[model samples]
Target: MPQHHTLYAAFADRIDAVLTALEHEGVLPPGTPRGNVSVEPPRDPAHGDLATNAAMVLAKPAATNPRALAGKIVGHLEKDPLIAGAEIAGPGFINLRLAPGNWTNELHAIAEMGADYGKSGMGEGRRVNIEYVSANPTGPMHMGHCRGAVVGDALASLLEYAGHEVVREYYVNDAGGQVDTLARSAHLRYREALGEDVGAIPEGYYPGDYLVPVGKAAAEEFGDRFQAAPEAEWLPIFRAFAVERMMDMIRADLKLLGIEHDVFSSEAALQAAGKPEAAEAWLRAHDLVYDGVLEAPKGKEPPEDWEPTQLPLFRSTRFGDDQDRPIRKSDGKWTYFGADLAYHMQKAEGADELIDIWGADHAGTVKRIKAAVAALSEGEGKAIPFDVKLVQMVQLLRDGEPAKMSKRSGNFVTIADMVEEVGKDVVRFSMLTRKPEAQMDFDFAKVVEESKDNPVFYVQYAHARISSILRKGAEEGFAPSADNLGLLGEDDMALVKRAAQFPREVEMAARTREPHRIAFYLADLAGDLHAFWNLGNADTQKRFIVAQDAALTGARLFLAARIGQVIRNGLALLGVEAVEEL
Candidate 1:
């Protein structure tokens, strides 16, 4: 109903209006492309409240110099009552200063929206299938899977807030060699459960104690029916049972970190339904697949036994991969990539877009999978936007040294161990404080520290302080009131300006598919709130509550409440709680 509720969007519309007016007057040619024009907050606050490059972007098309074009645009901008001033900077950048009342109006909007303050509708309700944390069902979730899980789950929530119909999915890799090993591992434990005196875990099987429960459950169900049987007679039954138990364990581990997937598509089911065969036949029909021999593996010392072998290869090289990839192995089983291609095809059937959050270790496979999706899009005659986000590994530490592994997993630290040590909030927030592609350290000591250096603590502390101030105000016979918002001053507006960036940040992060941006923005917002609160210590009159001035206190209180609301909304997107107290 409103032109725009957020300050940045409203100003963007205003700038577009100025451009349209210039075109009508013939100063700028009609139909000049404005796609590159941008309206955003200046990098340096000293420049102005908002800055735009409309003139520079339009100058060449309009056959005019940027500065001359900028002057005309500023003339139209300055006529708007909401714009206090419009200045032409170096080149053709136009900087705009909004009237104080505009900031006051935004603060009111924040209050009116509450939890929905930064919510966006830019996604236009397009269905998005995001497959994340699809860890193999061979073992419990360890720290190795932690980063992708957090990044993917947070990105899912971020997209939902930006108004997309998001389907959170997990692709269960049960039809694989890894699950075969898990079956053997569970079989050994089952033997021990039936009092067979099973020796030390053999070299190639999982050794985690977590499998003991699965083995016990199996022994109870079948009562040693498959024990001492041939590998063929028992492998399938054991694999099915072990994978189911492992998935249940994975689900519980994810719940500890506040994550749940809407769909768990099984690779075994895909193969049973011959989806991979369908994909291969379709590819063959389109000449996207052929019988080819892959060159020997490339390396300083190629395997001496390596030889060219004919296989069914997908034309991944045509789509930017280094070489055509084999879809089936010499043993006649589908390769992981082949199964994955079919899985993505299945996902694309229900969604407008596809996204996968994978670990950096899987970076080598990115190009081929992207190529497969592109090929599928070509055959389908419709463009399906696809993205693969890689999250680097997180190094765990205790007090500055590498943390120890979990005894239960007997391999690496599990997500449950990390969440139990610190908290879900700390684990989720700390994982997000840095960009996912960059390496990060999750020191148990530093994450739980009560210092400003810890982002989660700092942001949560800001929310807690606001809660305390509001409670104290209530006890002192006062409450936040917008009746005297006009009494607010420049220092107050500065905080409001920082709070106002949430909506813009939301859209930018969603567009880039980077949920970590939300975490970075929240840290900066919290820092601003902290600095504003510290002002009270040096000057009592600057405090949120002025004992002698009720109206001013109410206005400041109102500002504080809205700022807290924004912090809560951001933390929710990150899957972290906003604690009311430290």
Candidate 2:
């Protein structure tokens, strides 16, 4: 699109010229620094169509009053023929109007580019790895993980569309106390499969029937081998089988929600790959390892040997961490951060950039993770941009009431439950409809409803409505034509102009790692399209399929037809469907 700059580009160029002249004429200092300048439609269109803050930002920096600088910038901009007028307004802002033909040409760009109208190459084909939904393999995913899954997948798609080499990954928690607990639960279920009475589950043990199959499979494979062994003897065998089966079920559950990862990095594999011990060796080599212990957790006293025990530690505080982190526990086993450090160390091998999608509960852990990455990279933090997206909690609703999680299970709604009810599209779209930082309401009744309030329905319906119009137009021997798209009038042009925003917004969302922006942009475009479609009812001549004038109607139909393509293209990026009807 940069090769083919539209009227929008020319307007920006005119502003650039105004800035350049201001600097040259000494109205502003000769070498004053400036941030990237942006020109877009003003919030209140009555002031002018487009506005920029070039004057406001540079005013004090150039040692001049902001309003005075805005006046000077406006004076230089008013000379451009494409700019109908330029005004200095509120807080030294410069507002400019186009010559009425600029927006018309944006419509032509949409018709010409079709589905590719808004694509960008801003990424320059850099490699980016987005690791999300690393939900523990202990059970099925729930509503809380959906946000990360959708956001991660959408970000990967958006990055690819913006010309980046993207990889979506999931980190499996196959090694840990949780997996050991899973093994014991499976062993209990094994007893159940043998027709033995396995009484109530003990505390800290998995009590769900979901583990029964895992236990039965273990018994079939190992037989009475573990029946006579100690806890250590059965723990390994049980954990191996449990993690594998748990991962399989987790994958199936994720598939049901329409998500798949390109990579599945396992914590256990790090140990198998000789990386956990290698991390200990690494900290030792860098002088980052030290032996020290003093205080226990707040409000708790340590054991008898708690006095200054020399254990290995990673000097993470040197890289801006609040405090140095321990790598080896008092028992010499690697701490969780030790394995995570090695995991991220392994991640640094193939992935140029890493993004972790963590839930709100682990919000405090982000600082240490980033500090660890920086320490491991030896202070080159920008190359390995370890971004941690904190997904807020989900409060499920049912029958217009606050839905409570199963107290017996000790958690909120499961992903399987949400998928079974709202389906993949609604679940995915609803997860992305709001800012990740803000609270979102997921209404069961409204998600399934066929109303404009439902974003997924509204966007899909816009595409379907366009399909109907094109089908009707095809019956009248009309099809889209890039040659005569100028025949599309003001209302139709509005739809195209909005469609043209997708490519850039898609790139922006990816660059910023906020997939919610794409979801919102699609809805904005869909709203414009729906408004334009409804306009046909009020203005008969503006109807897409006009039987009387084939050429004029063909131009309008062609313009509107591509709007559906844009919507579908945008929806596809978010992993949301673009239905042709209904």
Candidate 3:
């Protein structure tokens, strides 16, 4: 086994050793900051296998010209057995082509590592708490919450693969006014179940028929005990019952899309524990909170009767927010920001880092919550890493027109509807085919189209094709073997190079906190495999099962098998299945 598992990582270490040698020989100055140096594949593959900007980055610090420095670096790099060719490009970039055997070794690594080929240890086992798809417990999961749910779940998986302890969380908003409205709605359905005419749902109540079941359950358990009770008497009991039922529906919908959370923190519980009161006292003691009058709202016409009231405000302006934010209203009730701050504080207690996946509509509140985290952590003499990722809305469409809303949800298409129509794999993969911050159109006609244009189908088809080839090769008495891999040609090595990039892609995607990159990388890898497969159409000799030469057939099957392994690994990270048959 090599010191570094991936080809690129191995070469990066080799470049570092060369720089250290140069420093020892006094050719380059010692203690020069090498943080800016980078080793990666050239933008143009024609340049070489690997390119490094070490000389370009260190030339000024070494007090020499970039090209001159590059020559010295190349002189040291060319001596290694792995370097088939090392040359200086136009200015100072050093491009080195590895011996074909190095890529062959990577293919062998894939076989040995199997499903663990692309897994990394970069996170060092740090705990990460990720809260995503925390839709209010007032309704079932809808298309509006689908993208963020997938992104967050995939990100949690990605971080785990990169060696982090991840806690998948959903913050239940059962303490809000929405749940109160849910109780009232469930009460109406309860009355209807009790043989009373409730008429049409009122203007402010939830009209979805999904609540009818909850109402029936209430009617069954209580048996008209609260049928004629006062609003105050049954509000609390019904609120808890309705919220629990809604959460059950939400969980079932998420399961259809293969998402599950590890934690379900409640806002009401946090308040019950006096977390907000403690947070407020801490902020006040540190002078981060004080009673102040709020200014007029921005970007709006001021009302003639608008009045400012003094309230306890957090000094968010000190941390770059536009204005100081009130933590509590004049009536002494905690505001939403106050509760959220305390919730984050609770989250920070258990993890080294915190990430919240929020809808784009919450963009306005990101800064304040971040500021609160900053204040709280900095006040404690240590700052915890915090990030808020805003996922934009997903527009559902059938064909080219807007899709119809589900009558069950009464507002938008439900997650269950999407999953049932297109299948879970299609829904998960389609949600991740684009960047989360950009608006996406989930066109039902386009996602399930069995063609190269559909990324999910194209990637899955590549795996299936490789599986078919391997099965036929076995039937023809040709088994995958690495003994004859040296016979592989340039076209075969091209596919090998693409498959070897999986480890690098995993590390990069985890570092950037962007799971969509895995989707994009798999699409490219699948394209490469399909291109290689099409070569047999031009010439029969290019096919994998060459009965005349069993060695060549076995070697080609080995390459195909490894390519399939890499595809399976990438798809697993995206929570998509690599089907053996299309």
Candidate 4:
């Protein structure tokens, strides 16, 4: 027997004890490795409640037959008070069925914990920095940036539920050439704002009408003083003004999706502080960077004017990268990778773990960044883990046709327009329906439809249905109370078993850094609740409300309440609301 607060943890601990007992009995060698042991729910419910592959995994190491080892393990598991039966099935697997009362106890735990039921301490309060949706400070955020925003926010929430101190960060690309173009574009608009016939926007400048207002704002604030000024004088002023205004637009767009980063690190600020140069100097002293003549990139033709020039490069290949990455371009200017390396070096100083969520187009860049972090750790003699999660594109559809593109952001659809069309909740939920790295389609018609195929609607309706039942039961003078919980039968216990998996699912999602798993789990749990509710329509005896039997009605209603409680908790992790009614 093992003492753990959660059901799965208890079983896992007990399985470990069985292995240790086998070691003590001389059935296996002392100090045998048990990393491969896994206790999980069987795929087929008919197999048993819980299944362990301890024997199958450890048999070869113990110099024994798997079936024989399974028989020995089952004997020890059968003696546990909570286990009703233990049997060996399917090639050296031990399946154990818990007593029905154990599920009732688990339900009681849910009732006591309420919204906090699924939260776990698996992360152990480790500091984790999650950087996402780092759209450039050029214009408003478009639909292309929506998936990473939702995925990152939900992941932060999920990690918090699993006990990690998560820092939501956004890196602002304010120092790049994009912002320079924005400045020149705004300067053109600024000339027009002063009633000048600036003619058409120049070929290289941004053409979006959104910047017209930014120029107008600058004119109203600073007057015509900047119009007659030289390019050198006005360029910095316009760049600063345009970037601040664009960042404001980005913040407002993110607000519509309920996302606000804890820290907005600026690349310009990093460069201004000489961090990149300092990092380069540190790397050079450590022999991590060297002057090198690069070979032409394979699989792609080199530029016609390409020459074998000596430039600074990081030894990324030593850390598993495909090739040595250049830290400085041939022009002797620090490249974007150099700035990012310093940014991550700063991040590693504060956090134990770093996660950067990027759009799928940046997939080719993952290895070099990982190598940089690995080199940083090796140089500092302190290990820091880094991961990059790439979110794929989302194709928006309406009535099976591509969505109308937004003129506000030029060719791309703006986040504001999407939110205005289908509401923020639908947009957030739909973006998360598929894995972050897997491309998906968001159909406006399907997302708002009342059908069960719409995951958001399906999961929300389940919670709404439960609330309606609780209200109906209340009006009929039947209320749920803990004292009458034992009246729930085996069928109700089955639902509790499903609800009990929430904690495990939360841990798994957090461990994998995939919040979509929570959405999927909630969808399945919602399906189970819907199926359980329909059982009442076919048989009056299965109804949750029994007018003449308050005790039985109370027990069933308590189970329903637990189901609703779990639905709320799971939805909260995804930042979706659990509605009281459809």
- The TM-score of candidate 4 is 0.97
lDDT digits (tens) for residues 1-582 of candidate 1: 122357887888888888899989998889887888888999999999999999888989888999999999999988999999999999889999999999999998998888888888888669999999999998889999998999999999999989898999999999998999999999999998998998899998999999999989999999979888999999999999999999999999999999999999999999999999999999999999999998777665668887778999999989888889999998899999999999888888888999999999999999999888888876898789999999999998999899999899988999999989898999999999999999999899999999999998999999999999999999999999999999988888999999999999999999999999999999999999999899999999899999999999999999999999999999999999999988
Candidate 2 global TM-score: 0.88
Weakest ten-residue segment in model 4 by summed lDDT: 1-10
lDDT of 2 at 102: 70
Worst 10 residues of 1 by lDDT: 1-10
Off by over 4 Å in 4: 1-4
lDDT of each: 0.92, 0.77, 0.91, 0.89
Give me the overall lDDT of model 3.
0.91
Instruction: Point out the higher-scoring one by TM-score: 1 or 2.
Output: 1
- What is the C-alpha lDDT profile of model 3 across 1-582, one tens digit per residue? 112366788898899999999999998888878888888889998898899999999999899999999999999998999999999998899999999989998998899888899888888769999999999988889988999999999999999999899999999887778888999999999999999999989999999989999999999989999989999999999998998899899999999999999999988888889999999999999999998899889999779998988989999998889999998877787888999999998899898899999999999999989999988988877798999999999888889899999989898899999999999999999999999999899999999999999998999999999999999988888899889999899888989988888999999999999999999999999999998888988977788887898889989999999999999999999898889997
Q: List the residue pairs that clash in candidate 3.
A: none
lDDT of 2 at 46: 69
Candidate with best lDDT? 1
Candidate 3: where is the Cα deviation over 4 Å?
Answer: 1-4
Residue 402 deviation, candidate 2, in Å? 3.3
What alpha-carbon RMSD in Å does predicted model 4 have with respect to the real structure?
2.1
lDDT of 2 by residue, 1-582 (tens): 443353445567777777878888988777676666677667775676678988888878778888988888877777877778888887888888666567656766666676566667767657888888999888767777888788878888888877788888899988788888888888888877777787888988987768878878877998777765788888888888888898898889889877888899888888788897876776677777777663465576767766766677777777776667788777877788888888987887776788888788887667777877766776334457689888887667765787776542456677787888778888988898888877777878888889998888888888888888888777768886656665767666566556656665775687788888888988888888788767779878878877787788867776776777778778888888887788
